[model samples]
Target: MDLPRYPYHQSLEQRSGQPQRRPVVIVGAGPVGLTLALDLAKRDVPVVVIDDSDRIGEGSRAVCWAKRTLEVFDHLGVGEAVAREGVRWQRGRVFHGEREAYAFDLLPEAHHKMPAMVNLQQDQVEARLVRAVQLEPRIELRGRHELIGLEQDADGVTLNVRTPDGLFDMRADWVVGCDGARSPTRTLLGLGFAGQVFEDRFLIADVRLAPGVRPRGLDPATPERWFWFDPPFHRGQSVLLHAQADGLWRIDFQLGRDANVDAERDPERIRARVAAMLGSDGFELVWSSIYQFCCRRAERLRVGSVLLAGDAAHQVSPFGARGANSGVQDADNLGWKLAAVVKGEGDDVLLDSYEFERIEAADDNIGHSTRATDFISPKSALSLRLRKAALDLAAHTDFAKPLVNSGRLSLPTAHVDSPLSTADAEVWTSGPGPGCPAPDAPLDEGGWLSEQFGRGFVLLAFGWPVQAPGLRVITLPAEGVAATRYGARPGSVHLIRPDAVVAARWHRFDAADVAAALARAHGRPQ
Candidate 1:
């Protein structure tokens, strides 16, 4: 497949004298920024996305997109292309010295719209998103525009952006940072990025297998991931193998802090490592990089009119594919709230939920990544002994299998205590609760319930509309997956927020109660 290049395009009408003002100015047009732009545009809020790149990034970075991210992409209108072009996998295996230690399945459920994970090249994913952004009427994507400076105050933010033409000042009601680890937006805010930096550096590379080449023991037909804990080929280090789209494979090798970064990245050296593991050096190396990443987050995600999302908001080690996946979810969570605030339908304080909920999510992912990293690359001899004992025991003992953590993988974070939730008025069984992403189900007519979301705040009613425009109602019969998933009675109701999170639910429907819940979701005082 040919690579994708996004030519620089200037869609925003330039301000010659006074800088033009927009509702939202997004910096960095990666997956998260593009998703936010499309999302806000769908909500009828205009957005301007600024990025320095003229093309999708090279290589397959962040290839493991999780299922929940795919669901959010469906609402953004690019999920079909992603699901069609990506390689789907759920099962994975962990090996300890050539012996299979354990095998696991990520998504055991059968009815999900997408699989547990999809391995698509980062460039391909960005290309699809770029196409969507270009076609969106309400979004202006300015490529090769560098955000050199930002200043925020009471009403809005002023950004000094440098384009190929020249530097110009622009203003927006809000400025969002989707910039990666080193964020200019974060720097402008003087935020203290705090977290632990792991001592080990990782070598990540993508390689295309020859027409008939198969790694010594890997099955070209199977999509399962294989992780090694102290493998024979790599000696003390751990390695990860993933099958990607287009007959490509991603290999991650752990290099201790002392490893010479330059020497380790040489093509011949990397090729020799692959030959050691695969018993052949026929694969063509596509890209290789040596870098150290930390699991950290900004001191705060929201600071007045300027906010952070994606890598700019927080970061985690690449072990669990938590970085990009969580970043996409961050954009999804903030888009509706920001749109509401901009359109006067919600209080500006509604943006608080973005900070509270996503920070909670960031902490959760950091905790998982930290534990996975420790397990993968033990810091001390004691830790190494324990990890090895566990992996070795996992080969024969079921109890030990549960202890092996080759990255817990990524799972949707439930915002159980979000301030936006109204708490269940009464007890209910089954289905999701307040602050949980709505449980998707097959409609009695043979579609998905989540497919009906992202259209703004709506009520999940088992029967009919209960007379509230603010809570637009959708009826589902009391006898099917919808009923079982929602735990709803014939007349019960569920208030789902615009972002598809449950704001509240009740065993009985009442217009007055649902209205109050809707207001609460918008950050209106009770």
Candidate 2:
């Protein structure tokens, strides 16, 4: 359901004489902004999201969502909706010289409930998030509102916004910028976004399927599959196909270096490319455009009272499906911390960890995307030959198949050095370590690790246990499911945070030590 727009005067009056500003103001209504708003709102934190666009655009930009991002969406209560509309691909086939060269199936069915990746257009994703945001009364989504400037002090941030009518100011305890790569908020903070830009350009077109011509390698009736054609446009071109729920397909092709922008605008050229790629499969072009890829990182993610998330902070080439996934992860990392500080559960120091953790994740993503891009589109003769040789060898070697398909190419985050992780503890066979998510395993009472613990502290007690005040501890039998899953041995304990990351572990299960660790993890002194 679309939200009714508020009159400019009414909005201004509501801001006047407000005793308490929201804990955070998120600028930009993209998936990152909306996801952060919903996450914080669920935690009972007041949040407002502002976007310059009055409505979601029709452009089909981001097309793939990673498995980790699907988990985050599930936590936000929109995963099922996404899954219903998304196209799931469990297998990928690589072709060389117009013949199938390599094929790899993703993780076996036992490893995941869904496929490793899904094909869902960014516009549809925005729609789902918008619906979820509207259902949350605490989350205010203001359209046609732009953040012009902001000033922050020790306590809060006062922002100047320009709406369709005029200018006004709103205050928040913290400000988050999710406003994309050319972020005005990032500019105001004097942050530098530095990186390398690939000079190659690509044209993207979203089109409807014609009567007989259907996308190759995917069933026309199934909308959950994607097709990638290498040497896409010609010898040096690439084409990506994403099937949409509405019987539409998105096609992306690399433009020849000699091609001009006018070449992209020519519908005949696009149709010819699509026809050639589809090979007798017909399609009608709906929309088309061209873009250049870049691999860049923000020098700093935080500047005083303002913080950056999503594309606003960093950008990666659209390879390995990193940009949208990384941005959503950034929102997940920052949302809870913002809520904790606002509710007086933690100090500002807790906010600093956002930069520490997300910056590292961004760096990992950039490296992964850069390598993937280089592998797919090698720039030099030597690199091209190397990639082809590696692919050729993989085609002949059974042992090398997994390496090519692991998509482990998208690096997972480990919080080994995060200040939030508790160190200097005896190694435990049963509990979670710092910077690690609690492993999913069965409980004694026919439950799961996520089912046993709510979005708060979970203390796992194995073997003989001692009582601790203000903590939720679940005792398990010796060598039981919990012990096996969390690597917990007898007489050990684990402290897990709401985000499911293990805060600390102890082998002895000493009440005093456990108390101190929990206090520190929760940002309180014992």
Candidate 3:
């Protein structure tokens, strides 16, 4: 589907005048860029987002968005539309040659607001984010505006943007590259990637069928993730199936490395494959693509005033859905820090934490992605045989089922060693450790623990009154989900960062201590 396009505006340089310098210029209008733009704009920071293409994502590239990413979206003002439009699923069933192996549920809790994951087309995500960007007066989203050159000094970064009118120089206090995997920004900075590339190939097909088309194993009304290892129809390879929103189903065929991409993607071959897998051919093929993934990331995410996020900083196998989700979190991580620095509320050292935190996140994601990739594509003869044996054993024994890895799925990452984290002075039952994301808990009257985070420094104290500048406080009961989840005791306080990460927690602390922690989080000397 074609997405609505915005009119291109010429910069002052293109109008035969000196280039206009802005506070922040973001190159790329993908989910990450738009998200960052929205966040910075919401913080009263003027941001200009430039994109090479006017259209949204061509295909349903990243279909599975994780819960943590949704929370970030909720802060950005597009979470409602995303949740309403996406298909929600929590349970997954694995099959070994037509025999059920085991089942796993990522989010079994019913008290939370969001699901374990949501399935929405990438285009749809971009559409909502783009619309939100357009409505923000502080943001200028220039679609079809391409970035041609980038140069940075100690003080600022300048970019050469090519619009329909002409190529013009645009300067900014900082330039962020959310341009994607083949990021021109990263290349221009001479900061490239280094990592492993698995030789396995996968073919993705999105097909639409009637709501009544029910397969034997699948429940037409309820959605679940289904994975098969060496099914009857397919030889030794694996297959993954997911039910998407809009009456669409996604099938991923584990085509071997030597498989012909051209022949396999042909409609007739794809139809035949679908027919054999479904035991009937009654679906319309919507799209098909072949892909091979690399578990890699850039050497560095930040250099001077230019920074890289999302696929630009890293590229991972889609088995875990880490690429886009982590990218969204990267934007979330940088947005508040960048905005604060632009407004002179924080120093550039705060921006340095973006590299520290997100690169750590990128490594964590790459590790998971690589593990899933290796499991999906075993190397040696013994490895292949062992993989099959494990899957076979998984069909019967519960112990063996845990060893099976049909894509480990996406999980939120923890920044265990972030520099901003203040160590806990005393222990508590369920409180998140410093540098960990604050867990969601059910509130007594009506609400959630996550609802209290994401705006500014949040002080969660039980049975005590604490207040500081730009700090929000939440009073928890002596006993409840919030109390237990936070290990909240009387006089306990937990300081949460704007990105919902715990900066510090105390069994007992003073208001001055909280102020110092906040200053440290903002890269100021305490």
Candidate 4:
């Protein structure tokens, strides 16, 4: 059997031309996959993404975008557009009852470049990412195409894809399985997806709120705010309200364990619940559905040439807004490593680091999200009493505020053993650390940390004048704007990776130390 030609143009011209396969073949066109595609494309690595979905749709699922996700978009150059469409949320009010409510402001100082969180529908986010993916010349997006099977060798992977016409085999240096939780690719590898499934089911409805009773502090025209109500439908259920970009409000109601799933599906039952909560608000129904929440993690993220990401790798409860955010982080983490290995800048063993770093991050996210869900869901009688009691205490004490907000919403990475952080340098102590994103700091030139560091490796030197010669370094003044912007001490230097992660930091160290750190990260001593 003659293999297809190696050039994309020739392969397309011959119709059976097997252009030299891309460095990576990504399955699934969701935000995770698209994000990986865009990042790899930006690094000039050829990539092909296959998705069964032909078009993007406006759905009310996974609507919260955290600051870390926003930072990622900023790196991709679509942050402004996302911000334009998204509603900035600085504070959240949690209600124990109608009168005993407590409000916490998420980003009070407003000094950071990105807001703490943004409320935007998941569909809108996908649309933006898809557009970005399409614009990249190195990315070939095959919609309506499905991955039927794939086999991996010591050097590369051969994928079997099914299209409307027939099945075709393509080879690639690497394969990424961003396919959702029930991932066929994962099944093909016989990898186990281990986690728990919550028995409670929740109904999500997207509807237009009547003009008279629009929720306070929410823009009727823009979907920007979230509201959580307790004792929904009865004394035990909970409800969540989210504003959508299309003037529709997304309402999630918890149906007790004994409630009939069929009855909840009825349009009348859904509308009745909406009316009961909003009270004669004349809400017009737009969309309604019910879904069970699951908390699971793949036994392994990488199986030879295949890699799992997004919901395929781990499914977390939605309470802490970790689902999409963590998925995107997985995409970001894997994208650069794939680009490096495929381009021959690094060894294939670098691929193993993706699982090493992201799997732990995913597990951490699951643990945090699970705790948040348990606190909010209150499955047992003791759990319910503890939740109510905690809420009561939070209403009055400042000590409880941090406890409630601790894991509810934050993107903190564990980089202790990551290859990215091989140095014993105390960089993580000053601010951002390796395996973790660099903190957003103001720049002297009226920009943020991202603007100054802009794509690729950056070395911030505080005092010494030694240079890597070939590496990019931005010098900071000893006591001026750069110092204020980066919170740089008099003799410290911060080394940032291509993806804007702090690879290492030195506080008044020898030039040899900086060279050693860079050598470890780039595989060559400066």
Candidate 5:
């Protein structure tokens, strides 16, 4: 499929030779930046999104969009389209050599609005996000408008941008760097990534099978993630296979540190690898590349009025699908808080919470990614022997299955330690707690519980008539999935943040208590 190219036009600031200050200026018109722009626009906050490139990137860089990311995308107005167009799968099979070790399911439970994971090419994902941004009136997307330099003061940030017409200056109350790992915005802010780089490399090939051709021993119609450790075709190495939309299959072959990078990138060599595994050559190589991944994050997520997000803030190995998934979550975490601060409903304290929560999340992802990398590519012979033993025992022993880490897979991390969460004053046996993403349940009325939350605080009152001034209060019967998931009983109340995180919950409703918890959620001292 041909990638859509967004037209680049000279900005008004460049045409009029006067700087315009925007509420939020997002650098990089990729998925993260565009998602943030749409999110902020939904909050009635105007945003200017600029990118150095006018076209979607070439390769299928990120293929796995997790459930939490899909939920975030749903609010941005592209969730339905993404889910429909992407391949949905939950089952994954892990293989040790030629034998199957075990299988796992990502979403064992049902009734959620979105699936466990969706595999859509990165380019297609960006195309959908770009179209969404275009439809939103409050978001101004300017392609080929690059940020040359930026200076931040107490009040706002001044950015020097280079456009097709000429150089221009623009100001923003806040600047977000969604540009990739080598982010220019991050460079300008003098931030550095502090983490470890894995000593192994991987070769990725996106292939489209010819007519009537299918992978050996696998149903092409069924989508499943396949990970192999020391496979027969690729001995002493790990391989990952993911089925994507539009007949595209993403395959990653582990290449040790001393492998020839250029030679491995050859189309014929990649084709040979695919043929060796599938026992068929009736496939066209769509894209191929070699990369060495790292589990690293920026020194700081925020510096004054400028903030870093997406790959600019953190990076992880592709093993767990953490990179793009976590980046989109960053947008979800920041959108409402930044909008509140920009609209004068919140202060610096509220915005700073984004830094704390996302940094914590980043560290968690980095740690997991690091562990996956180490297990996949053990540096020493002793570690390799241990990994082999673990895999050998995993097939028959339940105890050793946990030791086999073929990328733990991506799952949303709850900010249970966040300072924004109010301590639970009551005990609950079930349901999400403070600083946890609100679990979706099939409402007795019809739609899912998440469909009712908006871009503001939501108060879920169970079996009681409760009203909180200026808050969306949802009254529900204390039964069914909603009650079961929330552990809701008579007079139980839960305060949900704009991002659908549980800020606080109580056994009974009290307007004053709800108000105080809401204040704490907004970074105001109760």
Candidate 6:
């Protein structure tokens, strides 16, 4: 599919020969950068996004958008459009050789606003986000503008940008680096990632089956994630198949460390490998790439006045579909806090919480990625045997099924230990606690519970008439899934952050207690 291109234009700062200081200057125009731009714009904070390129990124890089990510997009006003054009699927099948080990459903129940996941190309997502950014008057997107030098002091950062027109200087109270894994901004900051880089490589091919044609034994039209371990066609290696929007299908083949990278990336070689597995050669190749993944993270997400986000902060293997999803979530986590600080409504320490919470999340994602990599590419002979045995048993015994790890799959990690969370003063059962992503439910008021979130601090009061200054007070009925999902009772109250994380809850409403919790959530000293 053809993608829309954006042309580079000289900025006002460059034309006027003046270094204008912006509220927030974001580097990179990928999905994460654009998401942050849109988020800050929504919060009434002006932001400028700079990228070295004029087009959406190349290839179908991250195709899976998780439920939580979709909810975030909903707040940004593109969730429905993305869901409508993307292929939605909940069921995934894991196969051990020729036998099906297990079939799992991501969302077994209904009534949620979004689906389990959506498969859409990265270029398409970026295009939509760019459109949104163009419409927002508060946002300025400068294409072909690249950050070459950055210096941060107590108050703000000075950036030396290189553009097609010429080199220019700009200033920002805050700078965010949303560049990819090999981030130039991170390099300018003299920081590096520290972690494991697996030698094993993988081949990615986007193949489009001929119209009205399907593989002999495989169903290309079915929107399900299929993972194969030691399949007959691709002996000893693993293969992952995912159906994407349009007639395109994404295929990943494990290529061992010693495999020829150049030969494997050849179009004919990719076709042969895909044909061997699909039992057809009539498909057209859209895009192909060979890559070796690593599980690594920066030492710190924030360094003085500059912040690193998305792949610049952390990077994981794509098996779990965690790369882009986690990056978008990082934007969701940082947008509100940064906006508040820029507006002087929040303490500088609140920005520290962004570092703390996102580092915790990155570490969690890195751990999962490391484990999945080790399992998928066992180095030791004993480890290989053990993995094979586990897969073998998983096909027969229910007990061993839990041992199978085809990438744990991306899920939002609760910031239970975050410093921002207000500890529960009362016991709770079967409900989201502090720092947990708020669960969505169909409200009796005809809209979903999540629709009321993302604007600001939300106080859900059940069977109580409570009011707090500057807080959006939502009185929910004490019935249906909204009440049940929250474990609500009469007089129960829950405080949700702008990012839709539960900050604190109370068994009964008390004005003083609510004030204290709100202050704590805002990162004020208790």
| TM-score on alpha carbons, each prediction | 0.96, 0.88, 0.97, 0.91, 0.98, 0.98
Q: Candidates' lDDT values, in order? A: 0.87, 0.74, 0.85, 0.73, 0.89, 0.89
Model 6 lDDT tens row, 242-359: 8888878899999998998877877888889999988878789999899998899998888899999999999999888888999999999999999999998788888889999999
lDDT digits (tens) for residues 1-526 of candidate 4: 1111112121241266463566788998888998888888888888888876677644668877888788888778787777777766766666655534467666676457788887777878887887787778888887767788888888688877776666677788788898998898888888898887887888888887666667544555543334454644344666676766656677777776677899899999888888777766587888888888888898999888788999989898777689989999888778777777777776666668788888889888888877776766667899777766676788798777554432377575756677756464453334555556776666666777666553567888776555765578776666664565555787778788765677777777566777777666654434
Task: Write down the RMSD of all candidates, one decimal each.
Answer: 1.8, 3.4, 1.5, 4.8, 1.1, 1.3
Tell me the tens digit of each residue's lDDT in model 5 across 242-291: 99999988889999999998888777888899999878898888888899
Question: What ranges in model 4 sit over 4 Å off?
Answer: 1-14, 17-20, 216-229, 232-234, 402-407, 424-429, 463-466, 479-487, 523-526
Q: Across residues 231-315, which tens digit of lDDT does each residue of candidate 2 receive?
A: 4435655565667656778777767556688757788988888877777547778788788878998899888878999999999
Query: How many clashes show up per model?
Result: 0, 12, 0, 6, 0, 0
Instruction: Please provide, for model 3 over 297-404, each residue's C-alpha lDDT reduced to its tens digit, 9 standing for 90 to 100.
Output: 999999998999999999989886888999999998999999888888887898888999888888888888887777778888898898888888987788888788
* Model 1 poorest 10 in a row by lDDT: 8-17
Clash-forming residue pairs, model 4? 4-18, 5-18, 6-19, 6-20, 11-17, 223-243
TM-score of decoy 3: 0.97
- Deviation of model 6 at 486, angstroms: 1.4
Name every residue pair that clashes in candidate 5. Answer: none
Candidate 1 RMSD to the correct structure: 1.8
Off by over 4 Å in 3: none
- Tens digit of per-residue lDDT, candidate 1, span 128-169: 898888888898887798888888878789999887777788
lDDT of 6 at 387: 92
